[model samples]
Target: MTEHAPTTYLLAGGGTAGHVNPLLAVADALRAREPEASVLVLGTKEGLEARLVPERGYELLIVDKVPFPRRPNAAAARFPLVWRRAVAQVRRHIRDRDVDVVVGFGGYASAPAYVAARREGIPYVVHEANARPGLANVLGARRAARVGVTFAGTPLRGGEVVGMPLRREIVELDRAALRDEAATTFGLDASRPVLLVFGGSLGARRLNDTLAESWPAIVGAGWQILHAAGERNELVDSAHPDYRIVPYLDRMDLAFALADAVVARSGAATVSELTALGIPAVYVPYAVGNGEQALNAASAVAAGAARLIPDAEFTPDRVRGEVVPLLADPETLGALRAAAEASAPAARAGTAAVVAQIDEALGRSAR
Candidate 1:
């Protein structure tokens, strides 16, 4: 009954919804382009992909793996055995399923997919969303036939700076409807400009505490807040009349779409989505790691998209100084919004070529 050619494509990304959801969006787009193409998700059993991928009506090939431990000694000791087992699982999937293309979307699941794709002599590509590429994606890009980047500054070799792939569902939301919806769904006051605050799932405690301490001033600015305080911050006065605090933003697309101006930590995915939507934000990148968050925010700033306020200066006084000015000046906020682009990640033209490459490689490897 289907008019499209039948093909199998392997979609890989996981650990967090940030990575996994984008992969799902890309795969969904592929289906829209060719309804007959079948998608199999290659993901770690331990990650959210296990729940999310299956929920989207795709078959999930689970692999047992863990990320390369950031901390050493005791954690590092388990790496060798885990690596061996992961490679074995990936090899088995390719051999058994006749997989077509292995696309790496960053994170641990891509590790095994990278190994399996190389071993099978298949065509695999890496889609790096961060300004500074992550470990798994860094290695994966070396052998990838093509590399796709969401940000302009990613160090992916042989990569084209394709904007981050977001879902059509997200892209289609009516902005006014979203803001009005978020006001009710999150129990926020429409009279005040809503400064939607969030830091992904499991939440950010430090951000939560700082927001709680600064809530009075934030309210005094004629602004209401929908803060996603981490679940651990149970003691904070989230139920106050002016504040709408939640454990998570179940509808992030709507939240970001509706927010007037947002305050949050800058993650690569956040930067991509905000840029894609043209949302203005004040970012407090985590004061840790290789300072990638700061680097990521810096790129957005270069584009006039956002402002990075150092975490050290996150006190009420400093927060009010940066925020009140930006909030009061619609001109500045408008500039930030103008930075969001509808075409930063445009690849619809080369999409069929990518899909064909995926199909040929996956089919050959499956053979």
Candidate 2:
């Protein structure tokens, strides 16, 4: 009997947390499943991966970021040469490292990784974190061995809804058990209903401004708030006893434990985490991109797990008129919670699904 050699993986993606986080989740999964496997991360030096990948104990491979030109200009004319350099860099790494699979999560790093993998006759996989796929993933999906998407409606050639691969902390979090500790950690009473407000890392100006204006009313209505005002937030603390405002939160699981409801931007990770945990949310999709944020939250909303407020209409008046009333109604909140629980997929297997696809491809290649 002969033992098979361990698989070698080259995971590519990184720029924002959306890409880096999912990449890390898959990396972590791969490592856990096959402890002896060699897992490498390919990313640009300037990306968050440079810091995060090494911290997470994976080898970080550097590649130059080549952004595709949308408009015809000098940069557009120079794109082909720059893009070629990136592909060549990736191809060299693939050859030298003897990578068995190239998994991409879509970033400036992924396009070249995809092209390189194809040229090298290596199996490749793609994971798109948005309902609307990005340019890199769109190009890569055509030839990928497997393509997984965070949302059901993502328009990719071979896309399957795999949910989002969540952090281990979130996947294992028992919110009910941690409520008292979480409430204490955030300096709020566990007995009261908590409304969690956040707008990503840098914070949402509109969300912060509206919540700041409406906090007095929110607190007056007997709800506590745990608001992460972002690192560069301009919203001043109103000094309410029940309201806790911080620039950022390192422990999101704690916040989720105490939160009865959430007000946040509907980024892929945020929506996935909230629904996975069965936490009801009022989504304020960022007013940018191809409206992907809104699309990300669509299923949650349609399933009655969440509500959506257009960016332009997310004002103090709307908060007072709409959000306040919803917060005040326990029955409505209960309904939302139930819906959230129903809407949330069995997310524990998201990474496994991706890994399964890779394994399937490997088996086929071997045959």
Candidate 3:
């Protein structure tokens, strides 16, 4: 009997944490399962992947960020030349690395990877992390051997709802076990229910403003607040010790453990993590994009796992009227927590599902 060679995987994505995080989760899963497999990451030097991929001990293959043209401008006219060059770069890397399959998380690097992989007669898979698909994944989905979506109702050909692949730390986290430690870290009473408020890494101006103004109300409701107010936020109030305001929390797992509920923007990762952990949330969708943030929070809201507050309606008045009452109501919070757990997809299994798709694609190619 002959020993089959180890499979080589090339994951293409980047430009944002949404793309990078899922890609890394899947890569970590693959590496953990098959220690000898060659895992390569394709991204532009300017993206977070340039630093992150190498730091995670994966081979980094640089690609040009050749964006597709939208309007008929001079840049649009020159797109064909640049796009072809990007595809060529990917093809060269594919050939040199002997890559068996390509996996794409939608980003600037993914379009070229899709084209090159298709042209090279190599199998590829696509994972779209939002309810609304990006242009790169939209084009790539046509010929992809398999496609996965993090949210339901994503309109992609052959798309399957596989949930978002989360980091190992998040996947294996035990909130109950860590509650005491988390409370200690935040300098809060573990016995009291805590509310966590954050808006991405840099923080949301609206969230900070509203929460700062409503801090007294939140504390008076007998809920401790762990607020990540961003590094640049100017809201200062040292008087309220129960309302802990930190610029950032390096250990988010600890924060999550201490949170009975959360109020924040409905970004893909944030929504996924909150639901996966069975924590109820009041999502203030960032009033940007093609309403994708609101769309991302739809399933949770529909299932009674979360509540949606439009950016315009999220204010101190709203927090005092709606949020404070909700925080005070344990029955409602319990129901929301239950719904969140039931609505959440099997997050830890997401990587396995994508890997299964890759295996099926490989099997077809072998035949």
Give each model a TM-score: 0.86, 0.96, 0.96
**Model 2: residues with Cα > 4 Å off, grouped in runs:** 1-3, 364-367
Q: Order of all candidates by TM-score, from best down to worst?
A: 2, 3, 1
Alpha-carbon local distance difference test for all models = 0.74, 0.90, 0.90
For model 1, state the Cα shift of residue 72 in Å: 8.5
lDDT tens digits by residue: candidate 2, 1-367:
3355987899999999999998999899889967989999999999999999999999999999899999999999999899999999999999999999999999989999999999999999999999999999999999999899888889999998888988888888899999999988988899989999999889999988888778888887889999999999987665777888899999999999999999999999999999988999999999987999999999899989999999999998899898999999989989999999886656555776777777776763311
TM-score of 3: 0.96
Off by over 4 Å in 3: 1-4, 364-367
Worst 10 residues of 3 by lDDT: 358-367
Q: How big is the positional error of residue 356 in model 3, measured in Å on the Cα after superposition?
A: 1.4
> Across residues 193-265, which tens digit of lDDT does each residue of candidate 3 receive?
9999999888899999898788899899999999998888886645677999889889999999999999999
TM-score of 2: 0.96
lDDT over C-alpha atoms for residue 24 of model 2: 94
Report how far residue 224 has shifted in candidate 2, in Å: 0.1
What's the lDDT for candidate 3?
0.90
